[model samples]
Target: MLEINGLVKHYGDFTLNCTMKVEPGRITGLVGENGAGKSTTFKAVLGLITYDAGDVTLLGKAPSELTEEEKQKIGVTLAESGFSGYLKVKDVVPVLAALYPAFDREKFLGLCRKFGIPMDKYIREFSTGMKAKLKVLAAVTHRAEFLLMDEPTTGLDVMAREGILDLFREYMEEDENRSILISSHISSDLEGLCDDIYMIHNGEIVFHEETDVLLNEYGLIKADEEQYRNLDKEYILRVRRESFGYSCLTDQKQYYLENYPDVVVEKGSLDEVITMIIGGEKL
Candidate 1:
């Protein structure tokens, strides 16, 4: 349960205008390439950065209006910030317990062991993947009802990413009303985990859709010059050049499937959709 409406932020040259929503009991993904305002949006939502304009409501109150206790209810795993490097993994336990009243210290320690995060080692000495797991573990084990995670699975191997995703699933299973808004460049991570997804580019929200609809209804059409000319462009959302001729993106996969039997149509994965939406020419 987070909602952002025309939330505007500006740096020297870059400006981010983002709008998104996370529903109760859902895992919503904010997906985009690097420097695409994913981190900026998160910062604004968490009140770590001041936005130029627009509204941000987190857990039913303005981000800035949220009290310390209210903030404790929202788990955050930010890419740009974390615990002091001098502290050992074990050293943060008491710190977290003091910060979060509902923190499950035993469960946190258990997760560290499960994820191979050495409790005795200095956090600065941990590998990137290890640090990532530690961040995710901190966010999830606190029993926070809402999670705002930016690149939570970064530096993790495929199996590790899956394990972390499974942890999120387990977190939600424990509370039916819990919600998560996560951002990741890994399309498969969002595709497999998110119920709904928002695609961001150049500081703006480009697309938001249900994962099921995106996977099942949206499609890519590979067509030669002749096939392209004959095909209906009504549903074509974007197009790009290809060695063969032209590749088209459409939200109506079944429409083309039934109408153009000769053309090559394939389901649009999240990666393909992003490639077309951000790189291809809009129709």
Candidate 2:
């Protein structure tokens, strides 16, 4: 439902170049470190920040071309931007209801109650986790077909995060036309929820792959200098040097396991793949 092509943004010395797609009825994840270009890319897609070049199409229109009515149909959660500190949880309901024609007040309040958010208290007084939860609740309850969430689970504990993830899954189940694009540092959360994941670093897109291919086929080979040297470098995607040994990432896990029976080959996670790609050298 979303398409970005050769998107480029520049800020003094920093630059962001990204390309990807978000299909209907799937959760696509953008994972990166704190200073990575994840946030910048999202801003560009939403037209919150003007980019120097490229095209961003959301729901069949350029972000800047989306009318007020069109804009209301797309949900958004910005990390530190949302309701003012002066507003209480109850006060937000009316504001959102006025803004989004299809907003479901009952569903919004139900989500707040389910997440244990106080209705009468000022949002400023709420903890970080409560604020984060409020933003997510506001976005999903608007009846938006598309969702762009930046760090939706931040400041939440394990239980709260799980609850939020389950809510997202339920939202997707409601309609095959729905889709979500989420960026978070919590790789484990994405592993369970995302259909595909994209990795960005230093203002550029580095890798994009299906979640299952990453989890099931990708692997890591931990070997000493000598063993690392002996293996065929063609299969290595990235290699990081460590004090005791070298850690190599490879998509050919079965190939390595069968050919180099002596080396230690283990399944790799998203975090491991990112670490090796950003920190290691490519073949």
Using all chains and alpha carbons, the TM-scores for the candidates as numbered come to 0.98, 0.97
- In model 2, the clashing pairs are none
Which portions of model 1 miss their true places by more than 4 Å?
none
lDDT of 2 by residue, 1-283 (tens): 8999999998989899899999999899999998788889888889889988899999999999999999998999987677999999888888998999999999998888899999999988999999999999998998899999998998999999999899899889989889999999999999999999999999888999999999988999999989987999888999888886899999989899999999999997999999998999977
Tell me the lDDT of model 1 at 95: 91
lDDT of 1 at 256: 98
Candidate 1 structure, TM-score to reference: 0.98
User: Model 1 misses residue 111 by how many Å?
Assistant: 0.9
Please list the Cα RMSD from the true structure of every candidate, rounded to 1 decimal place: 0.8, 1.1
